[model samples]
Target: MNPALRLPAAAVRTAGAVSPRLGAAVAMPMFAHVAKPRPVSDDDAPTMSLARGRTIRIPGIDRRGVDVAVYEWGRGPRTVVLSHGWLGRASQFSALVRELVAEGCRVVAFDAPAHGGSGGRRTYLPDWLATYAELQQRYGGFDAMVGHSFGGLATLVATAGEVEAARAVTIAAPADVDELFRGFQRMLGHSDAVSAGLRERFAARYFPGDPDPFSWLSTVRRPLPAGAPLLVVHDEGDRVVPFGESGRIAAANPGAAVLPTTGLGHNRILAADVVLDAVVEFVTAEVARHPVSPTTEAAAPLTSRAEPVGVS
Candidate 1:
């Protein structure tokens, strides 16, 4: 059977089950596969194995440790951290990393808990945020941070006064978690009852007090910190995440710069020279305008290169 055809068939099978209990049981695992990410591809191996990088493990929410694959390049004073989206690894930012490094800035990027060289099979929004916090703790605050797709949203949430950064850039990011859930539900052709049940289970497990996880995680509801500048870049023809989502982010962060690209879609936007140049320009300008205080700038410099290390 065609892979695309299998999901709808499974949804029908689960929805047609005689007992709701049976339906929920059957449906939950399918949803988990959708939410959980797969490893990076063979084609991405060479880039993922980029030299001068190190991997480390950090304790995440609930004290469950997650391995984070990190790549560091350049030796400039300012440090920029990069975060990749769902199913995305650190090396996806290879182009941007080079650009930032050439601009005389240190660049750091990491694979999320369950993606790339990281450990575990399941990950959540909190895990992504926790990973950022752990990275900040180790490397100190960032001069600028860039996140792509879901990573972009995670960056926004993590940097909400929790982690400090001079400026932030979000690329092809979804503005609302609710909308993401809705899209997932639609993709699986889940019925209303099934969708409601899934929501209940998710909320109970991930967010006990919050009835609406979507609204709770919405970037618009929790705006970025005051005086922190943001840049939102989205492709006009992006099929994965609607361009309107970027608009929502820009509206929420009135000071944010919304840069719309023409041909580059979701992932390609990362490699586009125009996009990379824009990012470097934005960060450089922002850093100069709002320089990190001497205290914030006192953190020790990152090692230019290191062998990847795993935490016990």
Candidate 2:
């Protein structure tokens, strides 16, 4: 009886009254609508007074004219990019931003297509990765990357040759795309025929030529690059993305450090001081461990001293 599950279930029931094919068609669009996060308003987000930042637009997936919104903060020697989860805005990192700046690390966060200040009515995982890759091209490699939930999956994907980062931290992230799809099917109570049909449409639309989109997009199937340090944090009470997802990532990568928390759930984990402290400590330690090379040391800084612009 979760509120989020109710709408999709109703839609499935309506569609099933017609035919399995019709049910699948109706369920697919409903799934997409629910999957693409709704935008978050400024009033609901934390105060953005401490950090200086600006927003930039980048082309979205398929070069479809949609623009992704990115916000950059701080001007420290080491840079860390943050990826917020589905339905989350860049400003959700307000607490972490303050801490990262205090520790002397520049921070960059973006609103994935159709979320926050980004342009679009619908979006998918490809759209998120596209926006992330664009930002990496604009700003160069990062010292570390931190992501939450869906963003966490994207961050893991980026480490696999898309972007160069010495370290990564993922909070409440799912490790397998197959598990995600299964969860979606359960939420909507779709029949096997309807689920298979939806999967076919999904594969055709997002991953043509790929025999199995589920395995192709799975973090567990395609593990993180060898020797790339990672920290996996998940809350025991996280009902959205199961904590076992984080466990899978940790088990798959022996080098990954797992930190389990209690009571914070999914969203609240982002604001918890203990989580922020762990992240700051890990990132700062990694930065210290890998000092900037003399050749790149002289390069101009990515941030400016001028007044920071507030991203809507």
**164-269: candidate 2 lDDT, tens digit per residue:** 6878899999886666667777777878777777777667665565556565356677666666789999999998888889889998777898889999999889
After TM-score superposition, what is the CA distance of residue 234 in candidate 1 from its true location, in Å? 0.9
lDDT value for model 2 = 0.71
Native-to-model Cα distance after best TM-score fit, residue 143 in candidate 2, in Å: 0.6
| Per-model tally of clashing residue pairs | 0, 0
**Which candidate tops lDDT?**
2
Q: Give the poorly placed runs of model 2, Cα more than 4 Å off.
A: 3-7, 14-19, 34-57, 287-312
Candidates' C-alpha lDDT:
0.70, 0.71
Residue range 195-274, candidate 1, lDDT tens digits: 66765655666555544545535678866765678999999999778899999998888788999998999899998988
Best by TM-score: 2
